[model samples]
Target: MRPTSLEGLPPTDNTEALEPQRTAPARSVVRGFMYAALGLGMMILFAGLAWSIRGGMEPPSTELETAPQTNVVSAPDPQIVSFKKGRLAYQVHCTRCHGPEGRGDGPDAMALRPPPRDFATRPWSHGETPEAIRAVIRQGIPGTAMTGWSELLSPQELDAVVDYVGTLGPLPSQNTEASDARKALLRRAGFEPVEPTIAASPLTFEGLDGRKQTLDQEQGKAILLIFWGTTCAPCMDELPSLDQVAKEFADAPLAVLPICVDEPDDELVREVARTRTKHLPLFVDRTGLARIQYDVQTLPCAVLIDPEGRQVGRLQGGKDWSSETVQTLLRTITSQATDLK
Candidate 1:
């Protein structure tokens, strides 16, 4: 018999007595459910707080416009070099009129009605592209004192200087910053930006060898027009590579015209002549009109024009002309006719 808590209750089995005591587990279960609900509510509150904080945070800023890719020589870590070049080029060719650092305070600045460009402060007067800068160097601003320096500087030097000048004003798309820096280096070196004007439109040139070559007459052949000058160092570096390219495409319709833009300095010209360059046509721009026609501002600027006169590819400065990719591109371009025809 089991002992009973109630006095009148009959004695029961020990197991039956223990059954009432087991109700504690049910109470525990209820308590656990209540605690679980409280934890879930707190968790939801914390999650809402986190979301609010995230919503209050500012979004990231957008990026600026990027500059287009250019067909110009690129140097690594070109900024410092560009700055030095810009400063130097300005002092040499531009200091007389444009003043130091393009502030327009040069000795000759006092004579001009509209003072020379104060490059340090003003926005670019021209469009902000390599081609745009090239255009200004090739064609002078109509009413301004900015005269075209087509003959004054080599094409590579001119591009370098113009690239430098572009950096003075408001920054163009950052992609061009490298090019601008290279230009600065050129500027500091006392160089001017110039464009090559090739008269290849009608292609009439009385070469140094006295052979008359006309652009119109070379209709059936693909023309690899190379504009170069004697003073250009980059052009010198590119000659051997150009020789290789000429040799590789000898049997093809491709024709290499290496035209010298410098004045007839017989001794200097002879020393730098392409004598060993097989199958390359060496020509000279007697009147310097070629620079104007082709808008060639720099030396070692090469363009591959198709049979119909559409430009296929352009290589600026020194390049590995015999590289498989470049050679393949040449082979492909020469094989096809231009859409311009």
Candidate 2:
């Protein structure tokens, strides 16, 4: 007879059917877990690749840190006092009385008795040489609205204005014989005539490689001597551009020497040269003898010496050495030296 319970039934074809029903759901769950694990592994691999690509696009941290501190200081052209600077100075200081073009018909000129000097007329009561004009700018006229600008402007600014004034009129020819005679008379009377340019004193210093050097050794070549210090912010700011100028004249007979007005330390100078100016040759003045000899009272000054060992000119402050105007000036100087040879 057919039994109600499995124990009383004969286990034959129905036994296999019961086994398949119990194990089917467990197999489906195992397959689902394996698929989920594979998807997670693929996501991790893609994330790693994206991170590497972004890291490769950026520069190193050291390069980024030193880039901004390279060179940012820029002054007016040092070779010639620039007219652009002169015009700006005139607008600020002389526009009210002398007018824009220096016609002497400004708003304040009408109220004055003697009136501002008419630069267009070229009838200067004082002398018309650059020296005379510079003197007037520094000392002012005895009876005029013009005040002494020695306190207001730098020597370079005064020179720029003088050059601008000459553009407005035909400057008188300089009387060299008379000037010499006057200077001689003053010397006889126990007075000294003020010289327009100061001569550079002799300099001797040690190089970064621990070799002794002297300015006399560079006599046959035009030398660009830069006085800088590690502690000076402006000096550091001007170094990179100066190095670029040196590179441009690598084949020329120009000696670009950056003299450090600090204690002599080969390692320190080398480090500074490597990071700040890669191509520049460095010299150190341990006793400040070079600074005293060159009369460098300011940081970031440059002294240009001709092939004859005479100082051509001196720039008293920082300048943009890589500017087009500065590059032209250096080229002219180098060309002149080549012509002499």
Candidate 3:
């Protein structure tokens, strides 16, 4: 009975042998490697973006990001002390060619064969006004030694320099020194001077038809002297408006005369005819004596000479003569002619 019951003996105590080995640490190591690779890729992408934008390749910052929100009003125009500051600037910068006091004789004059401009002469190297001088200074004279000073000087400084330079020589009236009687006659003739030695000369020129027309002959009439040249693009540009002005004043005693300083008179004559400027009395300056007298080296210059040969107004650059303001000035002068006498 003991041998037959041997197969159903008591249970064994080896339960630990039936469990699997631990693998959690190895799985964790693999997962950590993947995450490290992912982090490295992300960091590379951010670094690449930063490198691309670090240099001049980056676009300008937005106003909100870079600029302040406050409204920055510009500073007012500078207050000037006197003409000496401008004169000093010219002596330092422009004395090479323009000379001290703009007499065209600087220390560097010996270097330049033609030397510099002699502004004291009747035939001025440039125009009379600051604006005209600025244009020349900024743009420079071609085929000459004069270089543009636009970069060297600020606009205000240029203006100051021009104002100082404009005082280089005697004024328009000084070209023809008048006697005491002539001066008295001018005053009696309703001529007024804005600055000393700056009276407008009496208009006396032989017309195209050889008619000896004087300012006295044009009394009770309005005359406009447009100083221009065929070579001047600005002068050509302003022709249409000038035509309209002449037309508006046709019924009135108004004459628009365009005077050109180009030689070989027929060239300008052809230009006037081609442009169809019938409203204007075209005159060509063969000898260029008027250029010497009027100090009109700059082109497209205009002067408003009243019927009594008094210069009521003048303009140095291109403008619409048919403008309302110009018309008002014309009307005012026309109405005041009677009182001028």
Q: Count of backbone clashes for each model? A: 35, 0, 0
Best by lDDT: 2
For model 1, residues 16-76, the per-residue Cα lDDT tens digits are 7787789889899999999999999999999999988986795543442254422222232
lDDT of each residue in 1-341, candidate 3, tens digit only: 46676466654645533332345677788999999999999999999888877855867678647876332322322322334457668888877776765667887877875667877666665676767888988998887778888898887778777776666654554224433433443334333332333224433444455343544566666667787777777887788788777777777667677776663345445655466465666665544455655667678877666555545455677776666666766665565455555
Quote the lDDT for 45 in model 2.
93
Residue 32, candidate 1: alpha-carbon lDDT: 100
Q: What global local distance difference test value does model 2 have?
A: 0.71
Alpha carbon lDDT of each predicted model: 0.63, 0.71, 0.63
How much is 33 displaced in model 3, in angstroms?
99
- TM-scores for all candidates: the values are 0.40, 0.43, 0.40
**CA shift of 11, model 3, Å:** 99
Pairs that collide, model 3? none
**Candidate 1: Cα lDDT at 141:** 82
RMSD to native, candidate 2: 15.3
- Candidate 2 stretches with Cα past 4 Å from truth are 1-199
